[model samples]
Target: MGMNSVNTNAGAMIALQNLNTTNKDLGVTQARINTGLKIANAKDNGAIWAIAQNQRAESTSLNAVVSSLQRGQSVADVAMSAGSAISDILVQMKEKVLAATEAGLTTASKQALSDEYTALRNQIDTIANNATFDGVNLISSTTVNSASIKAIANADASATIDIAHANLSKTNTAIAATLSGLTGTVSAGDVTKLETAIQNVSSQLSKLGTGAKALDTHLTNVMKLQDTLDAGVGNLVDADLAKESAKLQALQTKQQLGVQALSIANQSSGILLGLFR
Candidate 1:
């Protein structure tokens, strides 16, 4: 226990302790630099790591939500495009129906117009059936009845954005069967009915447009939420490389100084030998 005892080197013990401390600090700095993260594991900061892990999970879930929204948006866009095409076809049909109403039309001429109108009507049905995305057709009755597109609004799946299908089938009352019974002879009531059908097609287009807009807004929101979660995770775990680099240099210097001090402490015994000589 004596301070001057030759067998017990107190100065060396103190220097060794300091060197161990410096080595520990240097290891920590090196690990941070290598990983680019201050909180790489729960051992670094348990609470922060837990929060960052949760945020990462939520961000991953948001990716699936964005995908769902995109699919829904595609279906809505296809339906809208089909509706617009149908609208154009209906206008052509109306013109043909008007031509049939003319006074001196030959039987062959009337039949030709009726045939063209029928072809156009059948085209509308074909377009509706084909306006599908990922097997979900918003305009077809058979598919629309079974399609209920819903997007997740949260990681827990507790909330959702629902998109209802719009049935634009030729048989649907919304667009009534005005062209189904058309013949060589056109009536005033048929003209009126065609006018109503045009209005219904317009209404369906407006509805589809509204739904598309809603989907776009939801997609934007999902992207923003994902960005926010990413930022949160970065704040929790990301390291400041510049700061850690500076610490690394400082620790290296301290480690060298510790080694030199330990060498000097061990040499104190040599000084005692010199006194005896």
Candidate 2:
């Protein structure tokens, strides 16, 4: 009985050790699931985890660039919106002038009409001045928003994405003043100067339109690159829960068998001790 009791104690100890081992393994598997990541730390998959970290940094930077691009687009859109209103005013002014030329209109009526046109032109200038986002006036500043951003990697894997131009020409208040003087002042030289200002505005609008288009195309590309980077990051660190779950079951089975084997060993020790009788 004594020998058998010794065998049972030995078997219990062995069984306890196996239980501890399986408990540790299950704990690790559970951690993987809770975190939703495969390489939870560098110790898991050193090389791949490191690469995944670098990709995350790159993704963060790309997100910043996307924000900048969005602001720039808003500025361009404001300009386009203001331009439409200004164009309508200009058309009205041209009609009024034609009507005055055909009929014998009072000078006061013409002057009043001219004053309203001037006011409308000034309003356009105000719109351009105020169209800003996060303190960066894309329409009014000379700062180049079109920058090339590279993905973060061990070796600079240069993937150049050129952002859209800021369309900075709308900041000039002088153009508004010059264009406004065209209808109200009514001098031969003033008419010529005003026509020249109108032409200048037209040219600027053309350039800005082109810049807006460029930025739009770049924005689309940025979104595509973002998606690609996300996929790569997922590949590096994302866990496979299905596989891990299967492994957990297998380990549990083995742990149970180990306990049975240990119990048998302890019983053998008990039998040997019986010889003392």
Candidate 3:
């Protein structure tokens, strides 16, 4: 430990330790700048990295939920559009029935009105059968109960938004069969049935509109939640580029100073040899 002893160089050991410390700090700063992440791995910050990983997984699962909701919304929209079209046809059929009920109508006119009425009723059945989206027909009895669409709200699949099926088929006796068997000889009963069919169609429309709105609201909320999750992950792992850049410059200067100090320390042993001479 003597100042002039060549056996042990304390100044050189101290300088070498400082240089190693500066190199380690420089490596850390360079890694942060290169990766753009303060906690790129669990080694950087184990608890924060684990939390960010879980949030990222949740965000990915929510994307799947959004996709399912979108598909369900599309099917609902198709069914609603078909229901509206059928309602318009029913109104026309009602007008034709009223015309046929007039006292002085000829047989030919009554037959013509009956044919038109039958055609309109058939069109309603056709619309119900064809109101499909992605092979899912909400208005068809065959497909209505086949599957219920659900939107997963969590990564664990414990929470969800359920969308029920709507069956408007003639065979289901929901809305399509309400206007069945109407001919040109319109009875008071036939007019009553037509009124009831109109009301049923209107009710179905309201239900569909409500379901669509609920889906839209759910989608909006899920999207907002996804944004929040992404922000949380960023807060946990993302690096500050400006801060890292400044730190890198400072570490580089410190490394150069360490090298100079180590060089000066190594020359101390040479100075001892000179003293002996």
TM-score per model over all chains: 0.93, 0.71, 0.89
- Clashes (backbone N, CA, C under 3 Å), per candidate, total 0, 3, 0
How well is each residue in 1-277 modelled by candidate 1, as lDDT tens digits? 5567699899999999999999998998899999999999999999999999988999999888888778878888888898888889888888888888888888788788888888988887788888888878777777444375676666688877776766666876846658563464577777777788889878877877877787789889889999999998998899899999999999999999999999999998888877777
Cα-based lDDT for every prediction? 0.83, 0.60, 0.79
Q: Kindly list the per-residue Cα lDDT of model 3 for residues 94-198, writing each as its tens digit.
A: 787677768888887777888888788788778988888887776666744334456565567787766666656566454444445434356666666677777
Worst 10 residues of 1 by lDDT: 143-152
Scanning candidate 3 in windows of ten residues, the lowest lDDT window is 175-184
How accurate locally is residue 220 in candidate 1, as Cα lDDT from 0 to 100? 95
Better of 1 and 2 by TM-score: 1
Prediction 1 global C-alpha lDDT? 0.83
* Candidate number with the higher lDDT (1 or 3): 1
- Candidate 2 stretches greater than 4 Å from native: 1-24, 138-199
Candidate 3 accuracy as TM-score:
0.89
